[model samples]
Target: MNEKTVAGYCIRCNDQGYLTDLEQWNREIGLEIAEEENITMTDKHWEVIEYLQNQCKQGVAITIRKVGKSGVVDIKQFYQLFPNGPLKKASKIAGIPKPVSCI
Candidate 1:
């Protein structure tokens, strides 16, 4: 019999950190949340993150209004389309640093 080895993504670096990687300071629970629920990470996700990061660099929240500039829907729609919160799983896959708020 073989046991299943679960692999998870790190919330901080988005690297595949497994059970041996679990630590207290900056580890995110719900391993499945990090492992599954990853979108295809299309240009759309990139566009969204780029806009959000730019706005964040300016000390502003990336709102639907800003997302509108990309012709994308609100965060709610993003979640609906992506099936997970913006900064939790998808953002990690999209290659954006985990938002401080999400930590």
Candidate 2:
């Protein structure tokens, strides 16, 4: 697969532009991705992002309902935090792939 560049970093991205090389993720890349998504990273947004990153590291599968149940934030708040396609966008911004339950 072809890799792309963002913020001067080589990135392997999917059709929707999520990182395929999880190890290549960094704060700079996350910020660039978030900017591309039109999201301003706030504390609440960080909460969910951190949660997803931690879960991903633990090999946990994330979902809207699972995030809601995780107590980091509820489903409505998750959508509010990442509007539109919350799980997909959040996972992408967190430098993880789209969740299986997402599509």
Candidate 3:
């Protein structure tokens, strides 16, 4: 298993840069990822991030349309939150792999 550091802790990540071990995730790590993405974490952002993480854990496909139906936020709002590519960036911040539909 490949290892990467986050919040000063060595953790595992997949080839595409998503955290391989969800157990290694934490708010500080998420904040660092959000910062790297040039996004400031807000309550709304946390809600969306957590939602996406949950979706990932459930093995559900994630997309703008799917998130819109989640009632957490509509597609437009998702864009406003994550700016340059909502699903992709948000998933990254959530420590979930880039969804298959992302690319």
Candidate 4:
């Protein structure tokens, strides 16, 4: 496994930069990851991130369509929030494995 420092913490991660250990994640790490992805965290973004983390904890398969129906954000807004590769970016920031639905 690869390791990188984020928010002054060394975190294990995959080659794609998604954290390998969910337990090693925290708000500061998420913020750093989002910044690396060129995203500025907002309340709505935090809401969506929480939703994704909950879904991941429950072992639910996450997809764009599912997130659209999550009532957190619609598909268009999801794109607006994460731009290119929303699901992948969101999953990374959420400290979960990259969704298989993303390429």
Scored by TM-score, the top model is 4
Q: Candidates ranked by TM-score, best first?
A: 4, 3, 2, 1
Kindly report which residue stretches of model 2 are placed more than 4 angstroms away from their true locations once superposed: 101-103
What tens-digit string does per-residue lDDT give for candidate 2 at 1-103? Answer: 5588888999888887888878899888888889999999988888888899998889987777789998889898888888998999999888898976435
lDDT of 4 by residue, 1-103 (tens): 8999999999999999999888999999999999999999999999999999999889899989999999999999999999999999999999999977346
Global lDDT of each candidate:
0.46, 0.86, 0.86, 0.94
Choose the strongest candidate by lDDT: 4
lDDT of 1: 0.46
Candidate no. 4 TM-score = 0.94
- Per-residue lDDT tens digits of candidate 3, residues 1-103? 6788878878788866678778789989999888888999899999998898898889888878889999899999999999988888898888887877435
lDDT of 1 at 63: 44
Q: Work out the TM-score per prediction.
A: 0.42, 0.89, 0.89, 0.94
What is the Cα-based lDDT of residue 70 in candidate 2? 86
Clashing pairs in 1: none
Put down candidate 1 lDDT per residue, 1-103, tens digits, no spaces.
1223334333333243322222221212332444465545555655664555455556665444456555656667677656745544544433333445654
